[model samples]
Target: MKLHVFDTFAYSKTGKILHFDVLLSERNEVKAHQRAIEWLDSIGEQGATIKPRGCTFCHTVADAPQFADEVARNGYAIYKLEGCPA
Candidate 1:
């Protein structure tokens, strides 16, 4: 299986910056992309998607704009500032 990392950042309820990341693997890139799409579907604009395992930073993009299409390449999905581990 190929490993993939998805990254993003959002603010906490207390105003602190919360950086989040999640790692997933699938048999191929097609499956990986599908997995990412499913995850995105599970979490709409008003919702947040939490990592089931690996990292546990909790995602909550309350007012941020859509980012997947503009930032991802080769099935990698990313959204936010640099330096977050994925």
Candidate 2:
């Protein structure tokens, strides 16, 4: 599994620095949900809110909800901004 991280920062309308991060990856999978989780974990081993995709098979999971459900409904799991497990 190959992982990638993105250095990012967020701000509020009042110019308040919301958060700064040098996101890192602990793992990578061909699956989209898994990959997204890996991304969130890299920063601090956390979970993230995931948006399901369309027809596309990933090593980690199936295509997505709409499409994936059509084919492998019980194959993959979906979530959005879920906290990481310790």
Candidate 3:
């Protein structure tokens, strides 16, 4: 599973991401989407602000029809880990 990387600095600048998240769903797109929404709701309780891909920082894959479509493409967060070597 590969998650498209999000720029931490950019996230900070945009004030869009309050916490980092990584999700792994079954290979099925429908289940993946359901999990994504759940993650959003669950983390939102903790003030984590993550959206599928349409929030405000999806320039990388603008051609994607929607954020759920983006999530269905991979089994991870759309953003990369903050301190890992990508």
**lDDT for every model?**
0.38, 0.32, 0.38
User: All candidates' TM-scores?
Assistant: 0.29, 0.24, 0.29
Better structure of 2 and 3 per TM-score: 3
- What lDDT tens digits, residue by residue, belong to model 2 across residues 1-86? 22222223332334432222221122222444444444445545343333333212323322233433322433323332223233
lDDT, residue 11, candidate 1: 38
Q: What RMSD does each model have against the real structure?
A: 13.2, 13.0, 9.6
Clashing pairs in 3: none
Q: Which regions of candidate 3 are displaced past 4 Å?
A: 1-25, 45-86
| Clash number for candidate 3 | 0
Indicate whether candidate 1 or candidate 2 has the larger lDDT.
1
Per-residue C-alpha lDDT of model 1 across residues 1-86, encoded as one tens digit per residue: 23344443443334444344433332343443344444444444223333333232233333323434432433434442433333
Taking the tens digit of each residue's C-alpha lDDT, what string does model 3 give over 19-73? 3333332333444344444545554433333445423222243233444555576
What TM-score should be assigned to candidate 3?
A: 0.29
What is candidate 1's local distance difference test score?
A: 0.38
